[model samples]
Target: MPSSLPSTLLFLSAGIFLAITGTLDAITFLAVIGCAVCSLLTITERTELAYIGGLALISISLILQAVLESKCITCLKADTLILAAVICLTPFQNFKLPAQIMSAVMSVVMFFAVVTVVPVESESTDIKPHGFGQYLEVQETSGEKLTLNTAENPVLLFSPSCSACEKALNKVMEQDADGTKWKLVLSSSKEKDIKKANELLKRIGYTGTLYTYDWHGSVPIVIYTDENDSTIVSHSVDKTIPLL
Candidate 1:
């Protein structure tokens, strides 16, 4: 019975580490719990430690989930509950198979309880919008140097053919038809695509300025800058088009 101290400490430390660092693998710990359940360890006083381990594992799973922010985190929570039940009820050394089964059930419950409390882009404006403004590379119909040396609230909107980019562009164009404050830059790598991008200007009726550069795989990049603070918001997925 006293020997269960080390195991409890180990499990507790693991749970706490998981909660803080959000890096421990809950599945591995669950597997450990499973092995203990199927073994003669469940019939010993040390079985209680396994239940504690289950609780700790769940705590770790939830803490890491909040920090890491992944869609797969729910799976971790579910699996931990199942293993915790085994630990809670299997500590009865004399109750035979029924006790072990009960342990399994309680282990699952402990798993659920630990997590029940912790309910806590992509074209991402995630990217700092920079270097997309190549206004010097632009040329008008009269071969005049199209420069944005004096435009107010100059917003450089870059996009390819991504649906998110398309949606963002449509929103920008719909709101700002004259394209005075918004600069839509079609990003493309292929030569044929550049020619197609030229039509985008005509489609938008943006007589103000048009700029193009070799697309380096970053679609829907928006850069908003002023004399005071420069803000770059770029993303490959759905994001707010801030070129207005």
Candidate 2:
């Protein structure tokens, strides 16, 4: 085997590390390890095990998600990589018809798994905030900018002190961004909360800019605006935001 292949596989495995939720999502890292294991399996004639191994990792990821009630996009991607590698290799090609049939079944299953697991990012101008923001006319706690309903995309008012707020922030950062951009407002009263929230954002590797504010212990809030700057969804920061 070419040495470059292993390097390439590892490079692919690392693609998910760029996610801003790297600190919050352990499943993504697990997928990386699984990919590495598959890479090693490729060196053997039993490369077919790579698919099985990857499938097992995916299963475990899903199980973990079920128990935790959270999903990992990067982990699913890692499994998809393994499935693709298996399809390309097709170790059962020279085997008996029964074995080849089984391979086909596995391939089909993998295809469905990929389709089902990957999340679709919404670019639709109208998104459901799920009844959270109910037309709350609110001004920016710190800045001169006000948003009762603005053209801006969803903005998360992050608080460093609240654990619920942190979890909600993680979900928004990981699930919403598929590439949607948003700005961060440091809207908390306690200086410690602001400081902590900033540090958490940095650790999460959040892609968007953080808007620094002189405001101080306001609750976390999410403001969703339509193209007309009309408030559609308004949610305050808290652990409960995950339900939205």
Candidate 3:
């Protein structure tokens, strides 16, 4: 058995773990590649490759936590473990102890960083209260407060950060007609969130009214009132298309 086999296996396992738990984003792709390279270096017993690969893995992990603002506990744990393993496996003259200690410190810093940087409200389970025909008032981007017209039916509740919302909005725009009245409500009122929402609307050339509402629920929600005045809330874009 190769002396470096355990480290190689650890790196490969960490890479697979990250790929499974993470979204298909650029940062995640880089991290996965870093892990694979680290594993390959370990198997070849190249000290220089180990040093470079280990440094890359450390940087990638920190980027995932601090720069990209990933809050996945599993991801953080995997990163910490991978860092520690890399530090241990790297060939450093009389520096293994210090490297391991540094890895531990980094793990602590990263754990605190993830907890403190992400807001508590992001994890709140509170959902929107009103459903169908309820009289709800939302704030427009122009700073005007307006009530949603239940008679209009089919109000779209979306968030700027949601991919599903973006896809649904695209479909809504494609199917838009001359007399169609499309009402869109931004589900989050955070300044950055509102900015993102507006950017998306502008990019897609949406001219409809966008109101801001403080709601916590699965997005791309389609709310409408039936002939009997009952409110219907749907999460499917196809269900929303006919009404649009």
Candidate 4:
């Protein structure tokens, strides 16, 4: 059996364990200890490359532990047990030095590596508020005579044909904005399509302004108006929200 293969396997196992557990834990600590044992064994056998390789494995393990944020107690227990086992085996060879000293050095290096490179904190911001400047102006269609009040709050449009648009509209419905004023303008290029849309809205019991024959239905564009329904905030196609 090749002696180096065991160390290689140990290193691979340590990497897999760290990836699953994420920053710190008992497993990572043990892996560091195992590397030191392998290193000492290689050193006594005059296998300098193997010794270096073992130390490298230990270093890598420590780095992973540090990155993952494993607890010191767990790491210490693992290191001590593995080093103790290696020291016991060192007596069989004509070694100049005990494994204890080498193990101690490797452990210290691992601790420093973790402390230096801490995990960065990440924050998530809602995409809805990024470009949400003002409320869109949703007046009644040319045929419809209802002049609905514009809700000072944000409103997203939803079309019937698009399933994705329906899902987004559902989310808006669930959102807590009972006091917020909103109007849905059902626009269709064809008169029949507009009639179908009105029928669907009526069937679903949606009490909002219905607009038909909207020639300017560019889609996903949020409209912003001033106090006097004069100017627009901006005309943009927001793909994140179905504002068509």
Highest lDDT against the true fold, candidate: 3
Counting only residues 3 or more apart in sequence or on different chains, how many pairs clash (N, Cα, C under 3 Å) in candidate 1? 16
The candidates, ranked best first by lDDT, are: 3, 2, 1, 4
Candidate 2 regions with alpha-carbon error over 4 angstroms? 1-21, 24-30, 93-223, 226-244
lDDT (tens digit, per residue) of candidate 3 on 67-126? 423234445546666766565565442466665676567667766754543223433322
Task: Tell me how many residue pairs clash in candidate 3.
Answer: 1
Clashing pairs in 4: 23-68, 23-69, 24-68, 24-69, 24-70, 25-70, 29-75, 220-244
Give the TM-scores of the predictions, in the order they appear.
0.37, 0.46, 0.52, 0.29
What ranking of all candidate models by TM-score puts the best one first? 3, 2, 1, 4
* Per-residue lDDT value at 202 in model 2: 71
List candidate 1 stretches off by more than 4 Å. Answer: 1-124, 129-146, 149-151, 188-191, 200-208, 236-243
Q: All models: lDDT?
A: 0.46, 0.50, 0.66, 0.41
**Could you give candidate 4's per-residue lDDT for residues 60-166 as a string of tens digits?**
54565445332232233333333333333333334426445665676676455434322212342122233333433334445545333333433444344333333
Task: Tell me the tens digit of each residue's lDDT in model 1 across 40-110.
Answer: 33345556555545545455545543443222223354434334444444454455576667555655655
lDDT for model 2 comes to 0.50
Model 4 stretches with alpha carbons more than 4 Å out: 1-155, 176-180, 202-205, 213-218, 225-244
Error of 4 at 205 (Å): 4.4
Cα lDDT tens digits, model 2, 1-244, are 6533643364355444423334343545566666666667655545556555655665675576445333344445544555556555454435446545655776676566555544344543232433334233333424344443224445665555334456667777665543155546665434454466657877766665555433322234555655554554343433223423
Q: Least lDDT summed over 10 consecutive residues: which range in candidate 1?
A: 116-125
- Better candidate by TM-score, 1 or 2: 2
